[model samples]
Target: MEITHHNKTLSLNSPVVMGILNVTPDSFSDGGQFQQQAHALEHAMQMLADGATILDVGGESTRPGAVDVTQQDEIDRVVPIIKAIRERSDCWISIDTSKAAVMRAAVEAGANIINDVRALREPGALEAAATLQVPVCIMHMQGQPRTMQSAPDYENITQEVAQFLSQRIDACIDAGIVRQNIILDPGYGFGKTLSHNYQLLAQLEAFHEFGLPILAGMSRKSMIYKMLDKTPQDILGGSIACATLAAAKGAQIIRVHDVKETADALKVVAMAVRENHELGE
Candidate 1:
């Protein structure tokens, strides 16, 4: 399958790596590191060279207990970086924002995908995404980012998540967002407990019943760090392991911070799948 937007296309024949480029001052990982426009562009180029097929640029931090930024501030933070990256390379660029204004600005600046953790539930989000006409990744978050992790209770994690995503899919279609342009993300750390996160990962393939591409973004998240009793910077191995597991389970997009390492891990997964297919035949 392929996602096309404004003369750009990304093939989902195999799992692809999406490098995280957070230009915010306070993301969970790599925040202040890329706040400068030049630095952000440099990191974007490096990720592309590291085998990332997409660069997900986020101007605001959605980390637990994170404060929200004004829509204009978000646009100011990301537009120049997006424009600079577009001027440099044509790799798939995903604007990771939940506001309608940011979505419009980023796409106007040059973003091919709208990766909203709110799943387009934010007031003008649905309308903006429908008008943008680019691929939209609707993630399932139980609550707002500030308090999502406080008390994430779920009787049946997979079922509930599936139900939420199903409803969101219907909502997107109703909003004039084409079905083929919709993508699914289970929102690994957005609002899930540690157990809930793993359960979702183990049963991620269940989401495929919707017939849309899945974007797994467990990279350097609490799901890995908290489980390993390590910090984000110390969980590269764990992150890659999770990415491999997600890809093996049929996730088409693996969003990650360490693009090179995740890319290398995906290569091994690809090889194993090829070998298995050949032997079975």
Candidate 2:
């Protein structure tokens, strides 16, 4: 499958890597590392070179307990970087935000996808994405970011998530957002306990019933670090493992910090899938 935006098209026949580019100072991992315009551009180019098919640029920090920035601040942080990357390359660019204004500005500055963690539940978000006409990734989060992790209780993790996404998908279609332009993300670490996160991953294929592409973003997240008793910086292996599993389960995109490693792991996944098909034949 392919998603088209303006003059860019992203193929989803196999799993693709989406390099994380957080331009905020307080993100859980690699925060403040690419806050500068030049550094962010450099990292964007490097990620593209490292086999990333898309660059997910974020201005606000969505980590649990993270403070929200003003809309203008978010636009300022992300637009220039998007423009710079667009000027240098025509690779797919995804703007990670839920604000309607930021979404408009990012698309104007050359973003191809709207990767909203709020699932377009924010005021005006659905309308903006509908008007922008780019691919939208709606994630399932139990609560708001500041308090999502406080008490993330759920009856059945996967079922609840799928239900929420189903409602959102209906809402998006109602708002005139085409079904083909939608993506699903089961919001790992957003409001999930460690076990809750794993439950979602294990049953991820259940979401395929929706027939939309799935975007798995468990890179350096607390789900991996906390389970392994390691820091975010030390969870590369865990991150890649999760990416591999997600790809094997038919995830279309893997959002991650370590682009090269994730890309390499996806290569193995592709090989194994081919071998399995051959054996079946």
Q: Which candidate leads in lDDT? A: 2
The predictions' CA RMSDs to the true structure, in order, are 0.9, 0.9
lDDT of 2 by residue, 28-125 (tens): 98989999898999999999999999999999999998998999999999999999999999899999999999999999999999999999989999
Consecutive 10-residue window with the lowest summed lDDT within model 1: 1-10
lDDT (10s digit) by residue, model 1, range 1-281: 77889777788978999999999999987879999988899999999999999999999999999998998999999999999999989889999999999999999999999999999988999999999999999999988989999999999999999999999999999999989889999999978999999999999989999999999999899999998999899999999899999999999999999999899999999899989999999
lDDT of 2: 0.95
Clashing pairs in model 2, backbone N/Cα/C closer than 3 A: none
Report model 2's TM-score to 2 decimal places. 0.98
Residue 97 in candidate 1, Cα distance off native in Å = 0.3
Per-model TM values vs. the true structure: 0.98, 0.98
Clash count in backbone of candidate 1: 0
**Which runs of model 1 end up more than 4 angstroms from their true locations?**
none
